[model samples]
Target chain A: MIQVENLTKKFGNVAAVDGVSFNVENREIVGFLGPNGAGKTTTMRVLTSYLAPTSGRAAVAGFDVVRNSLEARKRIGYLPESVPFYPEMRVREYLSFRAKLKAVPRKQRKQRLDEVMERCRVKDVEHKIIGHLSKGYRQRLGLAEAIIHNPPILILDEPTIGLDPAQIRQTRELIKELGQDKTVILSTHILPEVEMLCNRVIIIHQGKIAIMDTLNNLVKDQKIKLEITGNINDITETLKQLPGIKNISFTQQDLWYVVTIELSNNEDIRDIVYQKIVQNQWGIREFKTERTTLEEMFIRITTRE
Target chain B: MRNIWVLTKKELAIYFYSPLAYVIITAFLLLSGYFFYQFVAGIADATALRYVLEFIGFISLIISPMITMRLLAEEKKSGTLELLMTAPITETQVVVSKYISSLLFFIALIMPTVAYVILLIFWGKPDLGAIICGYLGLICLAGVFLSIGLFVSSFTSNQIVAVIITFVILLIGWVIGWAGEFFREQWWKDIFKYIGFFEHFDAFRKGLIDSRDFLYCFSLIIFFLFLTVRIVESRRWK
Candidate 1:
């Protein structure tokens, strides 16, 4: 439902979002993963039509963001990074106002207000002043405000930033439910959040997209770890001769030797390695294949040149 | 149009929700009330609300800034401008809604002073035509001042700065007509006389519904509102 091509947004001489392009299909949950000042917020701002791109173009739901900003914005429900609000307003009042601003039909306004308040778990605080609410409630109130109008596309900047662990889990579950039908592009610093919530992950660094791939494909690379009480040289030499063995490193942990093996491909060579170890008559202590987590991959991608 | 109403309603609610509106309104009423009493008791021919209206107009010079300072400045300061701008509304709608809300609050601020007119009618013969014209003039003058204040508030995130700058600008607009007397040249005189707010307002005080006065105030209102819209739109580009 969203398409961007070579989009570059520069603030004065500094480029906040530089030459990035991605498309999100309907009913897809795309997580924007990046560290601070990595252009995640900036990209979302451009998509929401809050900031005009310095160069290139972006369109939302078939409307150009700059030229048809009103139409494009109409389809997007954005929760800005800081979750700003008029503190004097009651939670219910604020949501009602936002619903009106988003052009929610008069007939459904009350129902929608209640629905979002319940879904975001801010129903108890609906009558309370926003300024008096705690950070977690305020964050949920922001989420309620975003979805009050039932927009098809949601661009949330760190939606679960301030919530507690249980609240975070609840919000993750809520987002997962919403992503079943809506196109969601949420930026967050939590790696597990992305792994659990996103179908595809886009890692942006230095205002450019570092890597974009499905969650499964990105974490498909595996590593083998083994602990064997045997001659380190002989074990290394035997492992090197096996096909699909990219590289191997060994570290001594007291009497146990910890060997980490990098596989050349997404291949299971455990049986071959087992036979080789048996042939060598090495005492096997531990053996397992570890699928690389998004955290490790994210650090490797972002920190690498 | 519905969006404008929605925003205006929210803006007005914000005014009532904060202490700023009550404080300014109460202060204005107390000050205006004291002056109204002084004008009525001190002058024998207190048959007209002319002086009182003028006093209210002058009081608005100070009160308009307070009314408008937070209209846009607070939104920018609190980051709610992002929510408003990202909504399906144009900058013009946002500016117009803010202007309308402040104007409504300004009207509410002056609504209590109508008792002075009633007092005059009960005690003496008062020209209702002139009185009506005076109120019309006040509304138009308020339109001009509040628009200027909204325009000033648009660019700044600091409420105090917005109020001070708006007051300064309105003061200049108010005093420029007096400067016209110092200009001996007819061209310079007309320019100052045309731009100054005092001249336009004086005509309404004298019960003359001259189109020139209405045009000048309305044009100023439209000009400032247009400028505010441009500033709001420029935010995206910035």
Candidate 2:
């Protein structure tokens, strides 16, 4: 439901988003993966008709963001970063104002407000002024505002940043449910959030596309760490001599040794390592394959210029 | 049109909810009332309404910036400008709604002055034509000045700076006609006269409805509103 081609937004001499291209299909929950200042918010702003692209094109729901911005915006429910809100207005009043601004029909306005308030779990504080609400409540109110219009597309920039773990999980579930038949593009600093909700991920770094791939493909390379308790020098030398093991390093604690081996390919060397330990009569303390974390992938991909 | 109304209602709600609006309204009413009473006690004529209106016109140059400084500046500072711009509305639409609401709030501040008109009608024979024309002149002058104020407010997120700069701009525009008297060329004097506000507003305050003054204020309103739209749009790039 959203298409961006070579989008570059420049501020003075610095390009906030440079030659970024990506497409999000209908009913897909795509994660805009990036570190802070990776131009994720800038790109989302262009898509939501909040900023004009300096070059290239972006369209939402088949409407060009610049030429037909009103129509493009009509289809988008945007929750911006930091969630700016009127502190004086009540929760329900703010949501109702948004519903009207988004052109929800007068007849259905109350119903729409009610649905979003409940979906976002902001019903209890519906009568409270926004300044009195906590950060989590304010964040939920921002979510409620975005969904109040029931638009076909939702562009949320870091929706769960300041929430408690339970609130974050609840919001994640809500977003997962919302993406069932609508286009949802959410940006976040949390990596596991993507693993849980996003089918596809677009990782950006320093105003450029770092990698765009499925989460399954992104986390395919996993590493294993082996710990040996007898003759630390002998175990370290033996593991380094094994095949298909590239980065073999030894760390010693008292008489125990932790041998970390990075598998160069998909070979399962646990059997070979175990056999070698038995042949040498070294005590095997622990053996486990470590999960390939997004941090590792992010560093390798973003730093590999 | 409905969108404009919706946005305008939001602006008005913001004004009423804040104590700043109350302070401005009360101060305006009290000062204008005191000025009106002084005009009646000193001049003792129907033209007292016109004098009070002229005083309002001058005072609005000071009061209007306070009314309009936070209109767009606060939105920018708080990042609500993104919300408004990303809504299903044009930048021009945002400008228009803000203009209308500021105008409405200006009317609300000036509405109580109608009691002065009522009192005039009750105690003495007031010239109905001049009262209407004088009030018309005040509204027109407000349209011209408030548009400039709105434009200045859009320039920065600092409300105090917006107020100070707008006050300076209006003050300069009001007094620029004085420099025209020193000019040897008729064209230079005419140009300055055209730029100065008091010349256009003087006839209106004296019960004369000159089309030139009306057109000038109307043109100014349109020009500054257009400039505001351009400045707001340019922010996306810079």
Candidate 3:
């Protein structure tokens, strides 16, 4: 339920979120993948109504981010990068304060607070001062505050940034559960977190949307690695003759041939390669096809600088 | 209005839970009380409560900065301003809530000084109207100083910087009248004296409820608060 139209944010001469646009459907989890200073946080801030766009428009839950920021904010929960909190407040008190700030009705604030506390799995530390809690608990508390009002849309900037392995897994599970019912836009540097939690991925680099699509399509489109052993010279020629081959290269050893190919469409080429090897009567020691992971894809897109 | 109340309540809770509030109030009371006691001892008359009120006006200069230095600066330093700004609340509500809550704490700290009023009642029979008017003036004075402090705090994340800037602004506002001495023109001297905070305090101490003086305090409060709102809103654009 979020639509961003040519959103751009400029801090002086720097365009933090350069002309970017995307849409998120109801109950869909969209992962924002980018490297440091890639404008991920800037875009999140624009969507959450925390910062005004230097140009263009955005709407959350059908409310314009500029003209109707208060209404837009009411329908979304945002956990900023780093999750800063009042250190002296107890966990429960802090959530209660955030509940009121979010305008959760007075009659339902306490119940809402309790529900979020449970949802974030922070019920046990309700009374402990937030400053005394560990980093994981603090992150959970930040999440709890974001959802305390039960907004339909969640914009989390790095929800699992500094957590340990266990905490990351727990947070991933919690985000998965959240995505089942609410529209979530998660911005993070961790590729696997995006892979496991998001159905769609939007990769941004240098303040532009480099790629945005379903994970399956992204992998199927860009992932191609060929390992084949045959008459090296003739095999290279045959592979280059293939219709959809993008690039061909071999290691210096020259004993094995590695060809990098980008398919024009989703087509199976394994059978064709097998037939070519048989015709040549060359021993095929290894023949495998592997797709690129999100990590590799991210590196490829961001490192193109 | 509801959001303002919620924020005010949260701010008040913070004031009580943190040591800063207690320390400021205790120090204020002890210092004001000592001065009040000494004034009575030297004058050997309880009627000198007016002098005590005048002196506490100066005490407000110090305590106002202490109460307000952390209002917005601490939020920026800790990054909680992002949370508050992202919530469904307007900038005016945030500024007003913070201003009122700090003023309330200042009032509460000064409330204990009512015992001093009772002391005057039993000993020297101070003018009840003048005493009441003086307390009203002190509250308004605190309101003006707190607004200045809040506005200054919004400019920087460093609490020390906020406090130092606030003190300097308050000192300028306090001493603008003296600068009139250098000018030979009556109009310039009159202008400086009119802008002085102490000039307004003098009207309240005389037990006269002038709307002009009330407007002066109200306009100063609104002006600084509006400046605070602009500063906060400008950050989002940046």
Q: Which candidate number has the best TM-score? A: 1
RMSD of 3: 2.9
What DockQ do the predictions score, one after another? 0.91, 0.67, 0.80
Query: Whose DockQ is higher: candidate 1's or candidate 3's?
Result: 1
Residue runs of model 2 more than 4 Å from their true location after superposition: A224-287, A303-305, B184-188
TM-score (C-alpha) between model 1 and the true structure: 0.96
Model 2 alpha-carbon miss at residue A68, Å: 2.3
In model 1 chain B, the worst 10-residue window by lDDT is: B41-50
Q: Which candidate has the top score in DockQ?
A: 1
Model 2, range A1-305, lDDT digits (tens) per residue?
Answer: 89999999998889999999999899998999887888999999999878899999999999999998889999999999979988899888888888888899999998888888999999999999998999999998999888888889999999998999999999999999999978999899898898899998899998998899888778767577877788776676877888887787878887777878887776677788888988998877788998687778877777676
> Is candidate 1 or 2 superior in lDDT?
1
Fnat for every candidate = 0.95, 0.68, 0.93
For every candidate, how close is chain A to the native chain A in TM-score? 0.92, 0.84, 0.85
- After TM-score superposition, the amount by which residue B67's alpha carbon in candidate 2 deviates from its true location, in angstroms, is 0.9
Native contacts retained by model 3, as a fraction?
0.93
Report lDDT (CA) for all predictions: 0.92, 0.89, 0.88
Candidate 1 TM-score for chain A: 0.92
Range of the 10 consecutive residues with the lowest summed lDDT in candidate 1 chain A: A296-305
Write the number of the candidate with greater TM-score, choosing between 2 and 3.
3
Cα error, residue A112 of model 1, in Å, equals 1.5
Supply the global lDDT for candidate 3: 0.88
